[model samples]
Target chain A: MTAWITYVVTAAGLTLVALIRPFLGRQNELFGVVFGTRNIRQDQVGRSLKQQYLIETLSLAVLVWGGLALMAWWHQQPPYLALGMIAFLLAALAATANAHRLSSQYHQQLAVPEAMRVSVDLTQLANEQTLSPVWGMVLLPLVGVGFALPWSAVAWANLTVGLVVGGTFLLTRHLAANVHGLAAAPGAAQARNILLSFLLAVAVVAQGFGLACAWQPAQAGLFSLVFGLLTLLGLLLLLITWLQVTRRQAPAGAVRTDNARWYWGVFYYAPNDSSLFVTKRIGVGLTLNYAHPASWFLLLGVVAVVATIAVLSN
Target chain B: MELTVDFASTVPIYTQIRNAVIQAIADGRLKSSEVLPSVRALGSALGVNYHTVNKAYTQLADEGFITMRRGLGAMVAEQLPAVDPHFEAEVVPQMKALFTEAKVRTVDRQTLVALIDQVYDEGWHH
Candidate 1:
C-alpha cells in the first residue's frame, strides 16, 4: 500500500510539472521560441499551437496513467513500477518535443546580424544573486562525514545519490551567477529566489533522507512519502511563480529574438557567444551555450560523475 | 552606470566599452577610485571574449581614465587625467568632420554653438 501511494504521488507530481513546463517562461516565448513583443495568447497561430500542445500533453498523460493502472493490477512490483515511470517520462518528452517543433515554425527573425546577442546590466555587478560559494564548498565534506558516521551498503548508495544532488546544487549556483541579464530581467529576481530556496530545501532533504535510510531502511517508504509531499509543495510554488513571471511584460529591448542561434527552439548554439551559460529563452533557468568550448567539458564532467556513481553503487 | 553595447553598431565592442566608461566617468556616474568588475566577469556577463574586455581596460588605463593593478583588478583613477596635447590632436580631426557635416547640413552658426554648449554643460551637471 505504501509503495502504491508513493508511485501515485510521484506520477502526479511529474505530470503536474510536465503540464506546466510549456508556459513557465518569458511572456514573449511560445514553446521555447521567442516572438518578440507580440501577444502569443492573442495571436491566432500561437493560440492554435497552445491548444494543440494541451491536447497532445493531456492525451499522453491519460495513456500513461492508464498503462500504470494496468501495470499495478497485473504486477504490483518495483520493476514494473519503474517501467511505468519511464514510459511516462518518455511520453512527456515526446509531447514537449512535438510542441517545440510546431512552435519553431513561427520564430521571428530580427534584423540584427549576429547569431546571438547578450545584454548586461552594468549596475548589477555588485549584487550577489546566488548562494554563497562557501556553502557549496562545504556541503560535500559535511555530507561525507554524515555518511561515514554510520557506514553500510545502504549508506554508500545514499552517499552516491547525495553527492550527485550536491554537485547539481553547486553547478546550479555557478550557472545562476554567470547568467547574462539575470538582474535586469523583469520578475527574474523573484523567480530566482523561489528556485534557489527550493533547491536548498531539496539539498537539505536529500542529506536528511540519506542519513535516515542509512540508519533505518525499514522506514524508507515513510521517508519517500514525506519527500513526495515536499516535492509537490515545491512544484506548486514553482507553478505559481511561473504564472506570475509569464504574466509580467518583457521590458523594452529585453527580448532577443535570436532564433537563429537556437536549433529546434531548444539548444543554444552561437560560436561567437563566450558565455558558457545564458538565460533560457524558453524556461526560467539558464541553458547551456553549446558553442562555448567549456560547455562540452561541463557536460563530460556531469556524465563522468553519473557514471562513477553508477559503478560505485553496483 | 548602465553600459550597453549593440552588436549592430559600427563601433567595435572594445571601443564601445572604452567610450561607455569614458562617458560614465565624464558624467560622474563612475566615481573616482571606484573598483570595476574583473575583465573575465564583465566579458562573461556581456557574453564577449575576455580579451575584448581586457583590451578595453588596457585602453582605459592608457587614456588615464582607470588604473589596473595586477591581481587587484581595475579601479577608476583617483584623479581624472587632464586633456593632453596628444588627446586634443586626436580630437581635432573628429571635431572637424562633425563641423563640416553640420555646415553641409545647413546648421546655422548660432544653433551649432548652442548644440556644443548644451553637450558640454550636460556632462558637468551630472
Candidate 2:
C-alpha cells in the first residue's frame, strides 16, 4: 500500500510539472511558439487551444493512472511499475508536442517575422541576481548526518542524495552566472530567483527522504505523509510562481521571432549567437544556446557525471 | 552606462564596442575609476565573442582611456593621459580628412568650427 501511494504521488508530481510548463513563460508564447502577446492572450482561438490542451493533458494523466492501477492489480512486478512510469512520461510528452504543432500552425498563418536583435543593459551586467551559492553549505551537515545514521547498509542512498544536491547546486550557479536576460524585465529575474530557491528546497527534501529511509518501519507511514505534504506545498508554490510570472508584462526588448533559430519549437540554436545561455521562452528558467562552444563541454561534463553516478550506484 | 551595438552596421563589432566605451567616457556616463564588466560577461551579454571584447579593452588600454589590472577587470583611468606625439600623429590625418570633406562640401571655416565647438560642448558638458 505504501508503494502504491508513492507511485501515485510521483505520477501526480510529474503530471503537474507537465501541466504547468506551458504557463511558465509569458502568455505570448504558447507551447514554445511565439505569437503577439495581445493576439495569443486575448484571441478566441488561442483561448480555445489552451483549454483543449489542458483537457487533453488531464485526460492523459487519468489514463496513465488507470493503466498503472490495472497493472498493479494484475501483478506485483517491479518491471511493470517501471513500464507504467515510462508510459506516463511518454504520454505527457506527446500531448505537449501536439500542442506545439497546433501552435506552430497558428503562427504560420500569421506569416510575421520577428526581429532577431538581442539587447543587454550595461548597468545591470555587473549585478548578480541569483542567490549566493554559499547557501548550499547548509546541505553538507545534513549529508554528514545521513552518513552517520543507523542505515549504514544504505550509504549509497545517502551518497546519491548528496550527489543530486551537489549537482543541482552547481547547475543553478552556472545558470545564474551564464544566462542572459535580454530585456530588463524584473519578472524574469524574479522567476529565476524563485526557481533557484525551489531547487534548494528540492535538495533539502531529498536529504529529508534519505534520512527518513533510516526510520523504523512503524514510523514509515508518518514520514511518507510528511514528505507528501512537503511535495504538495512545493508544487503549489511552483504553480503560484508561474501564474505570477505569466501575468507580468511581456518583454519590451528586441522582438526575437526568428523561427529558424529554434529547433522543434523549443531548443534555441544559433551558431552566431555568442550567448552561452539565453532566457528560456518555453519555461521559467534558462536554456542553452547550442551554438556556443562551451555548451558542448557542459553537455559532456553532465553526461560524464551521470554515467559515473550510475556506475557507482550499481 | 548602457551599451548598444548595431549588428547590421558596417562597422566591426570590436570597433563599435571600443567607440561606445569611449563615447560613454566622454559623455561622463562612465565616471573615472569606474570598473567595466568582465570581458566574458560583456561578450556573452552582447552576443559577441570574448576575444572581440578583449580586443576592445586592449585598444582602450593602449589609448590610455582605461587601465586593465590582474583580477581587477578594466577600470576607467583616474586621469586620462595627456596628448602624445603618437596620438597627434594618428589624429591629424583624420582631422585633415574631415576638413577636406567639409571644404569640398562648401562648408565655411566658421561653420565647421562652430559645429566642432557644439559637439565638444555637448559631449563634455552633457
Candidate 3:
C-alpha cells in the first residue's frame, strides 16, 4: 500500500511539474520583464508555450512508463528510482534548451519598430544599493562548515544542498542589485522584493531539510512530507508575488528600449551594448550578451561546471 | 543629480555622461560640493564597464566641474571654471544648427525665442 501510494504521489508531482513547465521563464505582459520583444504577439507566445508543455509532458511520460516497464522486467534489481530521476533531469535540461532556442527564433522574426528604438538613462539605477558584504559572511561560513563537519553521507548531502540554496539566494541578491538598474521604479523594486522573498522561503525550506536529515533520518518519510509542504509554500509565495508584480501598473518614465536582440530567446546579443549582463526579458534574472566575447567565456565556464556537477552526481 | 546616457546614440557614451553631468551642474540640479556616486557604483548601476564611467569622471575632473579625491569619490566643485575663450565659438554653431533645423521646420522666430526663454527661466528657478 505504501509503495502504491509513493508511485501515485510521484506520478502526480511529475504531472504537476509538466503542466507548470510552460509558465516558467515566460515574459510578463505588463512588466516587460523578460526578453522584451514587444513585436511578438501573445498568440505566438501561447502557441510556443503550449508546444513546450506538450514536449515536457511527453518526456515525463516516457520516463515514468519506460522506467516502470524496465523495473517490472528486471524485478527492480537495478535501482529503477535513481535511473528515473537521472532521466527526468536530463529531459528537463533538454526541454529548457529547446524552449530557449525557440523563443530566440521567434524574437528574430519580429520586426524592430522605430518607436521601440529609444535610449535609456542608466543614472536612475545608480541610487539602488548593492548586496551587502555581510550576507556573504552569513552564508559562506555555513557552507564551509557543512563541508568540514564529520557527518553521515546523507546528512552531509542534505547540509550541502541547504548551503547551495542559501548561496543561490545570495547570488540572486547580488545579480538583482546589478540587473534592475532602475531601483526607484515601482515595477523594478517590487520585482526585486518578490524575488528576494521567494529565495528566502526556498532557503528556509532547504535548511529545514538539512536539519531533519541530520537529526531524524529514521523519520525520513515525515521529513520528506514536510519538505514537500514547505516547497509548495515557497512556490505559492512566488506565484502570488509574480501576480502582484505583473498586475501592478507601470510607473511613469519606466525604462523601455529595444537595445537587446535575442539570438534564440536564450542568448542576448546587442552590438552597441557596453555591459556584459542584461536583465532577462522573460524572467526575473540576468542573462549574458552574446555579442561580448567575455559572455561566450562565461557560458563555456557555466557549461563546464554543470557537466562536472552531473558527472560527479552520477 | 539626475544623469542619463543614451546607449543607442551615435555620440560616445562617456561624452554623453560628461555632457549630462555638466548640464545638471548648469541647471543647478547638482549643487556645489555635492558628492557624486562612486564610479564603480555608477558603472554597476548603469550596467556599463567601470572604465566608461571612469573616463567621464576623469574628463569632468580635468574640466574643473568636479574634484576626485582618494577615498572620497567625486564631488561637485565649489565654483565652476570660467568659460573658455572657445566656449562661445563651439556653442554658437551647435545652437545655430538647432535654430536652422527649427527654421527649416517652419517654427516661428517668436516661438523659438519663447522656448529658449522658458528653458532658461526653468533652469534658473530650479
Candidate 4:
C-alpha cells in the first residue's frame, strides 16, 4: 500500500511539472537576437529541450525514485532501475541535441538595433558580414579562458581577469546601450557579453569545484562548515554584482521613457541567460534570452557536492 | 524613504514617482532638505524603472519642485513654494490605490519576506 502511494505521488508530481513547464520555458523568451530575414524571437523557436519534455524531467526524476521503490517491493534487481534511468536520460538528451541552433542564429540577426548596423544585409550570418576581425581576435582569448579552464586554479585567475575584462566589456555595453548601436551593430555587444558570460562561468565553475574539493575526505568537520559558509558568501557576492550591472540597463528599457531619450533607452539584452543566440542577427541590438546553461549546472554541482559529502559522511 | 514601481501599470513610472515625492512633501513626512533618495537607491527601492524617476526629477526641476543642476541631484524645494493645501488631499487616496495595485501582482508579502530572509542569510544584497 505504501509503495502504491509513493508511485501515485511520483506520478502526480510529474504531471504538475509537465503542466507547468510551458511557463518556465517562456522565461527564456527574452533572449536571442533578431537578424533573420524572417524575424524570430527566443520563445517562437519551439520549446527548449526541458520544456518539450517537461514531463520528461519530472517523470524521469520520479522514475529514478519510484523504480527503486518498486524494485525493493517486487524483489527485482535494482541495477536494472539504474540502467533504465540511464537509457531514458540518454534518449532525451540525444533528441534535443542540435535542434534549435538555426533558430537562435536567426534571432540574433534580428536583435541588432537599426542605428548600429555596419552592414545592411540582414540575411548574412555573422561570419559572412564583415566584422572587425580585431574584435573577434580580441574575443578569442576571453572565449578561450571561458571554455578551457577545467581546473579550479585556472578559473581562480579569472577573478582579477574578470574585473579587467568584464569592466572593458561593460564599458562597451554601456556605450552600446542605445538603439542606434544595438540595431546598427548588434554583434559587438553580443560578442562581448558572450565572452563575459563564458569567462564568468569558468570562474564560477572553478569556484564551485574548489569548494567541493575543499571538503574532501577526513577534513575536519569544521573545515566543511567554514568552507560551506565561504561558498555561500561567494555566491552572494556574484549575485549582487550581477544585479547591479543588469539594473543599470533595466530602467532604460522600461516602457515609459520620454520619447526624447529613446535613443539612450534602446538596450535589448536580458541579464544572465535570457540573451538571444547569434545565428539570426543583422549586426546590432543586444540579445539576452539564451545564456550558456553552464551556470545552472555549476550551481547544481555545488549542491550535488554538498549532498554527496553529507551522504558519504553518514 | 520607501520607494516602489509597477511596470505593468498604465501610468508612467516617473509620474508615479513624482507623485510619491510630491506627496511626501505635502505630508510633512519629508522635511526641507531631507535628501530625497538617490536615483539608484530609489530605483532599487521601487523596483520600478530608474530612468523614470530621474526623468521625474528633471520634470520637477522644470516645475520648480526642487532645484537640480548637473552633478548636483535634485533636492527639496527651498522655502517651500506656495501650493494648494488641498492638492495632497486629492492625491493621497489615489496614491494608496496605486500602491495597492503595485502590491497586487507583486510577489506576496510572505514570499517577499522569505526572499528577504534568504537575502539576509545568503547576503545576496551585498
Candidate 5:
C-alpha cells in the first residue's frame, strides 16, 4: 500500500471511532478530548444524544473526506507529501473547531438550577506534582550523541522538531511543579507528569531513529516498523488513561450546575468568575472561562499560531 | 482546604475567597505556618482571574492572618493578629442591630444566646 493509503485509513478509522463512541458507553462516561462534551445533563443541555452524534459524525466525515481527497491528489508526487500533511492537519483543526462550536451551542442552551452550582476550592485545586531537573540533565547526553552522528537536512530538521517537542514536555514539568493545588489531586497530577515524561522519552528515542535513518537510508523499513509499533503503544496508553479518567467518579461537593453558562460544557463563561481556567466538573481537563477577556485573546492567539504552523509546515 | 464562592451571591468574589481561607484557618483545616496555594494556581483552578486571588491573599496578609513570600507563595501566620482595641466598638452596633431585628421578629433572648453559643462553639479562631 502507498503511504497515503495508510494515512487515509488511519484518519477514517479514527473518525469512525469518534462517531460511534457515544453509543458504546454511558452518556456521561464518553469524554471526547477534542470533539465531545463533558458529562453535561442531557435534559438541561437541550440536545438529544442522537443530535450530538449526528453533529460529530457529519463534521468528522467532512474532515476524513477532505483528508482523503488531499491524499489522493498528492499521492503520485512524493515531493508533495508535506503539502498533504498540511492539508490533513488543517482538516483536523477545522473538525475540532466545528466540534467546539457545536458543543458551545449546546452549553449555551443549558438551564442550570441554582442549587446544583458549587464552588471550587483553590487550595485543593493546587497541583503539587514535580519532576526532578536531573531527568533533563540525563537526556543531554543522548542529544549530544544525536548531534555527533552525521546528519542530512531532513534528518536535522526531524531531530530539531523532536528536540523542540521534547523540550516542551520538560518545560511543562517545570511549570507544573510551581502550580499550587496540584498536589491536592495527586493521582491526576502524577499521571499527567508521568505522561509528559513518557512523551519526552519517546521524542528522544525518535530523534535517535532520525539519526539512524540519516546514516543509513536503506534501513528505512526497519525504522517504519518501529515507528508503527510506537504509535500503537502510544494509542494504547492514551486509551487506558482516558478510560481511567472517565470511570472515576466526581469528587464530593463538586458543582453540578446544569447551566450552559459554560459554552458547550467546555468553554466556561461566567462573568462573575474571575478565573481564566477552571477544572472541568465533568471531565479530566481544564476549560477556559470565556467570561474572562483574556480567555478570548488566548484562544485567538492559539488559533493564529496553529494556522501559521500549518502554513509554514506545508 | 475546601473553598467555594457563590457567583450569584452579593458577596464580592475576592471577599468570598478571603473568607473561605479565614474559615479554613478557624476550622483547623489550614494550620498555622501551613503553606497556601499560589495565587496563580488557585486562580487558574477556580477559573478566576489571578488578580482576584492576589487581592484575597493581599487582604489576608494585611490582616496578619497570612504571610506572603516572593517564591514560596502565601502561608498561614504563625500567630494571628490580636483583635483591634476598637473591635468591640465596631462590632457592638452591628450585633445590637441584629438582636433588635431578632426581637422584632419575636425571637427570644434565650434563642439568640443559643445561636451565638453554637457559632462560638463551632470556632472561628482558637
Candidate 6:
C-alpha cells in the first residue's frame, strides 16, 4: 500500500474506533443489567446495533491497507501475505465470537419483555438464540474482502466517509430526544454535555475537507482552513464537555439525587461503594477512565496528526 | 472481560455483555490477543457480582465464543461449529410460546403475523 492509503486507513479506523468503543461498553453494561432491571429499556438499541455494524464496516477500512502492506513486504511470496491475512482473520474471529458470547449470556437472562417486540423494538434480537453462532459466520465474508482490496487513497476516502457518517449518525441518535432522557436527564448538566458531544460529533464529520492533510486544496485552501480549524475545535469541545459535566455530577429530571437516572433508556444505577459489589463499581459513574477505548482512539488521532505533520515539515 | 450480569431483565447479563463485545470486536476496539479484564474486574467495573461475570465467561467458553485458561484470563475464541445454540435453545421456543399464548387468547394468525411484522420493523429499531 502507498503511504497515503495507510495514513487514510489509519485515520478512518481511528475515528470509527473512537465513536464505537464507548458504545460497545455502554451496550455491554446494558446487557449486564438486563435481568435485574425490569426498569431498564433502551428505546434505541436497534439504532445502536446498526451503528455498530456500520462502524465495523469502517474498521475494515484499514484491513485492506494492512493486507497490502503485508503483500508489499513479501510480494515474492504470496504465501507470506496469505499467512498475514489469515492471522488477521483469526484474531478478528476470536474477538467477534467473544463479543457475541457476551451478548448471549445476557440473552438467556433476557425475558423478552412483552413490550420489547413492539414495532419500536430491536430486530437484532428477533433471532436472539440463532444469532450467536450466526455472528461469526456473518463476519467471514467481510474478513475476506478486507484481505482483497489493494488499499488506495480512493478506497480510504470511501471508508472514511462511511465510518464518519455512520458513527456520527449513531452518536446523533443518542441525543435524539428520548435516548438522552436516560443519562442526560432533562434540565441537568449531564444532558448538556451529552448534547454538546452529539453536536461536536456532527461538526467533525460535516467538514468535507477529509483529514485536512492530503486533501487540502490551494484554490479552496482558505475555506478548508476555516472548516479544518473548526473540526479541531469540535474535538476540543468534546474534551471540555467530557471533563466538565460528566464528573460525579448528579443528574436532573425525574431522577433526583437519590435515584438512578435513565439516560438513553439504560438505567444508571445509583452509586454505593458497597452495594451488590457489581452495582457499586459498574455503570457509567466513572466516565473518564484512562484506558477506555475512545481515550486510546482520541490519543491515536492526536498523535497521528502531529506525527504526520512533523514528518512532512522535516 | 467477564460480563457482570443483571438477571432481572428480559435477557440475561452475559448475553448483554456478549453482544456488546461482539459489537466491539467487529468495530475493532478489542483486537485478538488483547487481554480482557478478569471477570472480577469486569463485574466491579459494571457493578455486578463476580459469580455473574464468571457465568458469562464460562457460557461464552462453552459455545466457543471465547477461550479461557486457568491463569491466563479469557481471550476471544475462534471458528467454532456453525451451530446457533442461542436460536435453537432459546428463540424457537420463545416464538412457539408467543404463538401458543396468542392462540390461547384466540388471536388470529394475521394478528400474530402483524405483531411479528411490527416488531421486525420499528420495534427492532426501538
DockQ for each numbered candidate? 0.33, 0.40, 0.24, 0.01, 0.37, 0.02
State how far residue A164 of model 3 sits from its true place (Å): 6.4
Distance from true position, residue A227, model 2, in Å?
A: 3.5
Shift of residue A152 alpha carbon in model 6, Å: 29
Ranking by TM-score: 2, 1, 5, 3, 4, 6
Candidate order, DockQ descending: 2, 5, 1, 3, 6, 4
What RMSD value applies to candidate 3? 6.8
Model 3 / residue A201 / CA error / Å: 5.3
Report the lDDT of model 1 for residue B88: 97
lDDT of 4 by residue, B1-126 (tens): 333344446877678667666666666555566555545333322322456657888876666677765665557787665656555776689867865765887857687667658955643222
Return whichever of 1 and 2 wins on lDDT.
2
Runs of candidate 2 with Cα error greater than 4 angstroms are: A1-7, A36-39, A55-79, A111-113, A116-119, A144-184, A212-221, A257-259, A272-279, A286-314, B38-55, B68-74, B85-126
By lDDT, who's the top model here?
Answer: 2
TM-score of chain B of each: 0.90, 0.91, 0.73, 0.55, 0.84, 0.58
The total number of steric clashes, by the backbone 3 Å criterion, in model 2 comes to 0
Query: Compared with the true structure, what per-residue lDDT tens digits does model 2 show for residues A158-266?
Result: 5655565565565444242122336624355466667667767877776677577566656877886788789779867975885686456665555445455666556
lDDT of 3 by residue, B12-111 (tens): 8788889878888887777788778777656645556678889999999988899999977788899888878667777899999999999899999999
* Model 3 bad stretches (over 4 Å): A1-124, A129-131, A140-186, A200-208, A215-221, A247-261, A268-280, A283-314, B33-47, B67-126
Alpha-carbon runs more than 4 Å astray in model 5 = A1-4, A20-111, A114-141, A146-191, A248-251, A256-314, B84-126
DockQ value of candidate 5: 0.37
lDDT of 5 at A16: 58
How many clashes does the backbone of model 5 have? 19
Query: Which model, 2 or 5, shows the larger lDDT?
Result: 2
**Looking at model 5 chain B, which ten-residue stretch has the lowest summed lDDT?**
B40-49
lDDT of 1 by residue, A184-243 (tens): 346554565566666666666766676776677899889877886787688678767755
- Give residue B41's lDDT in candidate 1 (0 to 100): 63
Query: Which has the better DockQ: candidate 3, or candidate 4?
Result: 3
Please give, for residues A1-314, the per-residue lDDT of candidate 3 as tens digits. 56545655665666566455445432322112233333233566646655665667676667665676467557844335545556665665466556656554554555323232222333333344545435434434434545565555534554555555455454444242222224223455456556656655566566556656656779978888888888888777776676466434332333333434553244566664456655454444556668879778766866775686579769
Task: Report the C-alpha displacement of residue A268, candidate 2, in angstroms.
Answer: 3.3
| Number of the top-ranking candidate, with TM-score as the measure | 2
User: How would you encode candidate 5's per-residue C-alpha lDDT over B21-66 as one tens digit per residue?
Assistant: 8888888888898888877556655545678989999999988899
